[model samples]
Target: MVGEFCPRLVDYIVLVGSHSTNRTSSSIQTPVILNRFPPTDHEDFVLPPDVALFCQPEGCFNVVGSRPARANSDSSTPVRMPISFVFTLTDKESNKVRYGVCLNFLRPIPRRPEGRKHSTSSVPAVGEMPRRTSDVEFSQLPLPRNSDRRQEDTGLHEKKTQRARSSVRLRTHTLTSLCLITHHPFFTKFRALVEFLHTLIHKLHERSRSKRSDRETVWGVLAGGIPSTTSSLVTRSVQEIEIWMLRLLSAPAPVPGKTCIHLAVQPKALMKPLIFALPDKSRLPLVDFPLHLPIQLLGISRTLRILVCLLLEQK
Candidate 1:
């Protein structure tokens, strides 16, 4: 009997082992033994009639086997076992622990295409375009080509030259006129006669005013061609008159043929005796006088006679 039971027990252990490994691969398993047919006190006896079996996953298991099952055994209830399996597998080669495998069971991925290349003749080179010359000959072109502008400049220059020449001619004519007027012989003689007359009139007027009463008394004597008393003042006055008369008569007359004396004869006769009264040595004559008359009168009388002779010669 024991031999037959051992074979059955061995078969049951094999089945449980296979089932546990298979279930562990997919999930986990828990097995529990209960005291029923195999009681602890009757280990050498036959298998107990009150034994129980409990099976669960690897968590929350319990054992229950009391007496036997009259109708129901309290120990025959399913045991609950609390079991936990924490798998900590370490990989030494790549230093990575993998829990499960991820399978990519689809087609292979595609790669990106390579870039295309271009030929050199597809684009134009920088030196291929035609270029315009920046340097040009501007000086060779005809200058502004306006005949009116050239003529206007030439006419303006000629007008300025003519005005300068006309101004010079006008200045030359004015200078020539001034020279002709200043050097005229008639004008020279006329100016000299006027100056002489002015001097003679001034002297006569001064003498007349100084001797007004005496001149009034001597007016008859002078007209009658007679001599008065020989006073020194009368003599001096007469001398000044004589000198002025000679200056007037000596100047050249404007008329050619007649001398200044012939032209002025009446004026000479009227002034001669009045001038003779002065005792001037320049008026005295070279001829001898008769001794019967006073020396002063004779001297004066001779001077008048000499003046008349000179006048006749001049005429």
Candidate 2:
């Protein structure tokens, strides 16, 4: 009877094994069939992973083997795969070890416009680029020294001095011409003497007339002695004219080498004849006496001519 009981127990174990296998096979087959199922007009299907495993407790287990070999697939075909890494965290409350795999699948960052990059490493540092050839040449060039600038200034000064000398020579020539005209022989001999007398007489008459009119009472006594009065007036007039003439002749001309007489003689000569030709009373005051008048006029002419020449030279 004990032997019979053992056989029955073995039979029961076998029966359970067969039922378990059938159930596992059915479950696995269902997924495969569904993956292989044809797509409907409105629906698409996706295949499941070749291997999958679940962990229910803290333990070590091999979840998958190496990837299956691909058959006749292009080597260059891009593959999409999930990358995983183990992470361990300790549970504080239970003091238990927890394990997880981080599926941090890496993806290439999308290129920006013209493939620009934001990260610092892709760009050059402050001084990494090649230096320009032009810049190197400019740095090697020598600076302009002070001696070059000094030579330019020296040349400019020489040009200025030459201009100044030319102007001085021209002015000297002009002055010489004016002096020659004044001292011409015809002007000096005849015309100059006449002008001198005319100027002298005019000045004397003017002085005498002023004195007589201003001192009428003093002249009233002298008026009765006509001869004495005339003589006295004439004498004074002649003396004053002579003094004025001498002064005019002696006055210096403005240009260094030229004399007053040389400069003024011509103009004075021209003026004398005009004065002498006037009616007696209208003539220059003391010209009625012709004795020294001509010589005196000559002196006056020389003086006036000198003044005019000086004035022209200045202009």
Per-model CA lDDT versus the true structure: 0.29, 0.30
Clashes of each: 17, 16
Per-candidate TM vs. native? 0.16, 0.16
Displacement of the residue 240 alpha carbon in candidate 2, Å: 1.7
Candidate that scores best on lDDT: 2
Give lDDT tens digits, candidate 2, residues 93-199: 54433222222111111111233236865556678995555977999988867997788788888878866554332220000000001111122232334334344
Off by over 4 Å in 2: 1-184, 188-193, 210-236, 244-315
Q: Where is model 1 more than 4 Å wrong at Cα?
A: 1-195, 198-202, 216-229, 251-315
Error (Å) of candidate 2 at residue 242 is: 2.2
lDDT of 1 by residue, 1-315 (tens): 001111010001000111121211322224322111111322222321111111122222222222112323343322221111111122455343211101101111111223445666546566786554354655555566478788989999998997665533321000000000110122223233333433443355446536654333222122222256354544555456445444443433222222122223226756431111112234542222234334444577776776688989853
